[model samples]
Target: MKLFKSIIYICLITISLCSVAMIYGETRQSQWIDKFIDSFELTNSNFKFYNIKANMMIEKDIDMNELQNICLLIAQNLTNNKDEVCLKTEKSQVYVNYNDKNTGISIVGIKKNAKESYIIVDILNNKVYKNIENIYTKLENELSEYSNDVDINVCIAGEYTKKLKKAKISDILQKILYNMYAEKISDIEEENFLSVNAYSKLLKENNLKYLDREINLNIGIRYSEDDDKTMIYIATPIIKIDY
Candidate 1:
């Protein structure tokens, strides 16, 4: 009977450890969002949120076929039997796009690499802030089942109907950085675009280095003629989507 009790205790401890590993990168979502929203509010641009997106990369030495199948399963679980389109296929890559129009959930998956397969999952939605948090939390939980070592990037974007000048955009970026008490590591300004890379001790998420400086905040702004609006993207670590 003592041996049986010991075995049960071991199982319980194992399960608890697994649970902690699964939620590796989830504790800072609310903080990140609040910072993003509050910083943007400083601009006083009165922009409307375009979307909240998450890009997650899972790296493990798995076969391309296995990665593709896993991506398919993840999409199905995300969209609940929605139709998915195979966007592209190459010798070493497969891209799938899943859109559940009714739910406003768009998921794109890609399995690519010549030597070792890596999976990229992009999930986007224009829902309430709480809903966005819930969606990505579920996604992280699901992806953790496959690989504990996953890298995630979450971003929120907003747009103003009027186009702003390059100087104006730069001022906006500076305002946001100052509001967040972030250290500006690097910045670029083009005729129609402006971006700044920064680091802040207030953020409790992952960090990457650029030119020997730690960076966790990324702010970008550009004018889009297609939408007749000026777009702004704020992300932690970096922005993955094209401006």
Candidate 2:
């Protein structure tokens, strides 16, 4: 049964990209960010992650100077150490870079374009010299402060490649399957089929407890050499991400 569940989860990971389209009310970029965060959150309590790049475009151009100041302020709020954040101006861009020497986590912000503007941030997960809250999450919260004006079109590419681990995938799969099963049974109401949640509820009545955890997932986009159309893969490789 465990092997079967593991196989099912692998398939689900491969197919999840397509299945996610049915989900409404969230932008693809935001969903992608959520998945990025979820992968780390599931494995460790305080694992830090870095970003490759994200787009933070506003409806109209805001003052570039003001925006750079905001980035500096956000960095200050996250740290007590002075000189941790250094500011610099390059052609058509202003940068705010943070170096957390204690934890080796660097959060960087970029404001681009001369007349119009947008923000690109890279969350670099340098070696975990110490435990710290994830940098992307902090910067994400900072972005929310300007939500009224900015049209967030953040997308990221992996700078650090990861090796997928099957054991980790299988462990997280149990939770994903249980949650999905619960949702299915609640809406469809099959006559003979009982959801894992429903069965767990029955066990709870008899003083036994069965509970499920949530899995953070994103759809895998697979391109095929044989076919022109790209495919969705739910059974994704479990990977260890590092710089």
Predictions in order: lDDT: 0.68, 0.40
Clashing pairs for predicted structure model 1, backbone only: none
The TM-score values for the models, in the order shown, are 0.68, 0.41
Candidate 1 lDDT over 168-235, as tens digits, reads: 77688778887777888998887667888899775645588789988988888887777788878877
Report lDDT (Cα) of residue 75, candidate 2: 61
Compared with the true structure, what per-residue lDDT tens digits does model 2 show for residues 114-182?
445666554444454122224444555676675543322111212112332446434543444343231
Q: After superposition, how far is residue 38 of candidate 2 from its true place, in Å?
A: 9.2
RMSD of 2: 19.8
Name the Cα RMSD for model 1. Answer: 4.9
